[model samples]
Target: MADAVTEFVLTPEQQDLRRAVRRFCAERLGEDTVRRLAESGTGHDPALWARLGGELGVLGLAVPEELGGAGGGLVDQAVVAEEFGAALVPGPVLGTVGLAVPALVALAGAGLDEDLLASLVEGARTAAFAVPDRGGRFDPALVTVTETGGALTGEVRHVVDGTADVLLVAARTGEEIGLFLTDGGERIPLSTLDRTRRQATVRFSATPARALAVGAGAEQAITAALRVGGALLAAEQVGGAQRMLDRTVAYAGTRLQFGRPIGSFQAVKHRCADMLVLVEHARSTAFHAAWALQDGTDDPDLAVAVAQATCSQAYQQVAQESVQLHGGIGFTWEHAAHLYLKRAVTDAALLGSAAEHRERIAQLVLDGASASGGVRVATG
Candidate 1:
């Protein structure tokens, strides 16, 4: 696995691109701007999304060059996600880049809505995809949306970026589940702990729908999109955790106690050291998952599960410690510390929770062990 990760190292050009994205976020996503956007009723700014999609080419990173995309893959997206995570820039990037684009790509055989794909690639239209309930579980039985007679009737809960111009829904069709497309639906914004990243409940009753691709491989395609989404989200968490730890350390150094810097104390030093471990682990796991997904390794599912579980916990813990380490200011709503903390918790629940991932890890390992004649491997 380490060798696989070594092979996936970012090239100089990729590193340069990452720094460019950092600059983009720094210039456009200033602290004041982020605050204003967060406080606003609408979490997304179409103008900002356009600039990122068209100028930065972030939305099209995974699309082919012929499709007006940057012609990159999951690794490139992980890099962009890391910067976005560091900045905590709020928008529909998750659904547009992670879910919508992947779904379109997977369904290319059915002549995926090229117009929709092109619009997304050019950042002309935003999109959202809803799957898995708030419990972070995707079960066909739980899918409330039903398609009948060329119309979709039912509601989708917790649709990521459901406020976009397009909404792709996963619905049960006979014995198999398939993807459905719609122009728009009734979007009910859900009040969340983290307002930076918006989520909404989409209600569709007898709404006209189009089937992009149905029948075989549909389930696998949905899983693939979700796994990659989780991987990119892990990258974001790593960035956030790094920022939180760095800020906490800096604050500890400057904050005086008993006529000396608080960081000089053994307890504070130990906490910082612990935080460093979490940040490093989160980064490594996220990168490993990205590489595994890109390469389509034999155990990509396990890799995603482990990465999601490890990174989510690391970020949440680091966030909690960041708040505690900063003492009083951390508790204030105005502090960026609380923002990261909220984002961490929200991310943890978005796709799945730490405990949920752990359950998956256990199931996958046990099944693999039984199939492999009872040899249990470490969580790798």
Candidate 2:
């Protein structure tokens, strides 16, 4: 019998999707377009958003077909996310797809509002998961938003794309935590390090809300959503790191220093080689996490935690190296390197920092060891 193959490779359809998204982004979401949208009031292009949903059906990759979605999974979504990250595509893609879709899907059987999901699938609406903490840590105890008599009241800060048309808010009712759906809130946009992504403070003053899930169910949904977010975010970081690596290598080959291409120098060659290793490592971990989320093969939480820890740090290092490799040109606002660097730095803190994920990974490992009685100590 042949040895079982273990290498992870994208299916033909996935490759096709990647190629199409890359082409679309290159054509429509160039650096100039990204800068313009980042400075715009809305911080996203509505027309391009419509095209993504109506033409590419990217917005519904994780939605079930019965719900008017493509019935695809996280891997499919990761492909699109990677391309978006590479292009630094602006808008609420992360808010709607990465955060909202998973939460809604997890609560689909628990009085989930299908109408809202349908609107998101069609790109007619965008949603934000209004969770506490700017660092992407979703602690149920930190939920201060209170729901009373079908009304939500409290303030949620550091909400990604908080101005979204729909808000899937986590609120406390009595001793139980619940996921509430609301369309009423005062959105105040906040200045952030990553101009490509928007954050805002949402103040809900007795805003009418509908309960989606309460108690244990709501907690589970929230956890699942954040796990998916972290996994996809790892993929996004991999994309950004790969882009920087590519750009740095190309620049090194063409840049002249002392009348010879700088790439020929030992120092430049070593830096590029180190960048390649990091990109490859990040890509492997991120893709594995996506696969785990989709297929349930590995411990999904462990995979996600490892991916987040590895990819976040890798992306930040690569972006920083890319800027330095470009010398003075990369430091300028006119150059695209600064934008990627900002995104990398911001992403490191977006869904918790590298240190946070590493701690989670360690705890998970110890817990697993304890459960299986695998931990042992050596003594003299």
Candidate 3:
């Protein structure tokens, strides 16, 4: 069997992009700025969104040039996600880059690619995926669709970046399930916990929709796109967990109690050490998944499953420990610890929980590998 994980060596271009995004975040969205952004009632700053999507072209990095993008791949997007995670940058980075762009590129076959990709690349518009309703499951076939000619009627919940420009919604029509681009859905109110990432319910009662092609490879394409998202999200969780661990360590070193730094205490040291272990493992898992996605050489689903499983737990553990280490301030609204905790909790449940991913990993392992390297479920 292959090693539980493999190491990745980044190309010079990939390294450069990672450095650029890291520097940008440090300069433009540092700790103080992140704190203020989280507290701000505006939810997300439109100006920052414009700079990221339009000026930086971050939104279209993964799309192909023929479809109006810089032609960067999932690895590039994962790099950006790391920076966002580190700074806790408040925006639709995951929704737009991770979910929306990939889904659209996969669904908008042939002729539609040019126009749709051009809009996204140019930042003239944005897109979102309306799947994983209130319960937040990726079972696409379960989404209900009432199709009436050019109109689609249904309700999609937990629609990330739903407040954005265009929505690529999943719907079932007759015997086929596919994604459609719609702009006429009525928005339902939602009480969101993460201010940085908004969630909402979309009600489509005869909403006009432009059907996107799903071809014969639709399910595979959608699953591929989602696995990429899952892998990138794992990277984000790893980054976030590292941040939490670093912050807690720094605080422990300086926070004096009984004439010595709190970090000197055995209990605090053990907690921080445990955090390091989880974060390191999560990093390995995420990096493995990223490489698997880029090369398309392994079961992307299994890779993402392992990555997500480790990441969800890593983030939760790191966040909880960071708060506990910080003592009183961590629970206060003025501190940034809670923000990390909130984001970590919300992200843990994204795509699937750690438990769900573990089940998937088991299923993939039990199914074994086909002659062509793809995983296959043994039937009969």
Candidate 4:
């Protein structure tokens, strides 16, 4: 009962939006649709993408209304993300809400580029961060950049939605880090294991670029944007994990062994129970991060790290365990369990890994303690 009624102090509007989005995903993008989308090599449904961007208005959930967005906050978008996760709906919800929108907003805050932000918010355009390289460690300082006339040149890899119309690229220009908006840069193809998200190795060979922001301020803006995106991705992972758990439980109940429900057995029951607990915990952590992000709390960054670390593991664990509990059929092409597993693994490493985020949290805590007047001498 508590599981069904677990409350997170959401506004009535947020609750209604959640219900609506959930119903929408269940009706339109159900198990069959999700399976089809995941199996596609492109890792997305372009038709569904158009609907999400143009009709459902999910693309603009985090965008401001004045800029043609729905004027919703991070919490509001988290509700939709939760539904997206639960349905295993494939596309770029995290790409748009988490990365693109936040990048624009952060840049706008710095008064960098209003036109880019407007295009992003209106859903007429999209952008992906070209931060991570082949090793997947995205340090702004390590990024190499060159400028020739009005063009910028460099090689950046693992860019999400790299095929988008616009790209917000972070490049190192001497001692200054720069954010560039490039509409037409050379995109090199890269092999991807996950079929639900597209990635590319970009080669900007003196491509025409507009400077969105620069200097240490660019690094700060990009980092803040990534944090926002990472927190939202956790919510998406929670949704996906919940859906996997539901599907696995339903399968366990129906798949017979020894002339009885497999779910009736202790082993299967334990696995299902563990999945449930992890999903619930992931939900709590994701909501906490979303709340902090929406409220603009001082500890939102730490909350984001915690949520990403916990939710990433929870998603992967639930997905893999769900597939295992389904038996041999789960390994086949007909079943959707493996698809969820792929999405889980891909998303887990997207923003950062569990280990990476945990390390970041430790560092943040240490920094906080150091900033607090060299620690307090507590009384016994």
Best by lDDT: 2
TM-scores of all predicted structures: 0.94, 0.95, 0.89, 0.88
Report the lDDT tens digits of candidate 1 across residue range 1-380: 34554654788978998999999999999777888998787786778888888888887787777766788877888989988999998888788888888778876756378888989987789888876643344566777777887788888877878888888888777666778889767899988888898889999888888887665666666776787788888899999999899899999999999999999999999999999999898888887788777766537767777778988999999999999999999999778998899999999987888888888878778865775478554433
- What tens-digit string does per-residue lDDT give for candidate 4 at 157-198? 777767777777777666677887777788765666666667
TM-score of 1: 0.94
What's the alpha carbon RMSD for model 2?
3.5
2 or 4, which is superior by lDDT? 2
How are the candidates ranked when ordered by lDDT, highest leading? 2, 1, 3, 4
| CA shift of 234, model 2, Å | 0.8
lDDT of 3: 0.75
* Comparison by TM-score, 2 against 3, better one: 2
Cα TM-score of candidate 2 = 0.95
Q: Taking the tens digit of each residue's C-alpha lDDT, what string does model 3 give over 1-380?
A: 23333335666887888788778778888767776775575456667767776677776777877778888877777777877787788766666677777766765554255676677667666667776632123565567865668788888777776776778777776677666778778876467677777777888988888767543444544565577778888999888898899899999999999999999999989989999999988987787777677666556777788889999999999999999999998999878888889999999888888988888777677656676777553110
Each model's C-alpha lDDT? 0.82, 0.87, 0.75, 0.75
Q: After superposition, which runs of candidate 2 have C-alpha atoms over 4 Å from their true positions?
A: 1-7, 133-137, 371-380
lDDT of 2 at 288: 81
Ranking by TM-score: 2, 1, 3, 4
State which candidate, 3 or 4, has the greater TM-score. Answer: 3
> Which ranges in model 3 have alpha carbons more than 4 Å from their true place?
1-7, 31-42, 108-111, 133-140, 214-217, 367-380
Model 3 poorest 10 in a row by lDDT: 1-10
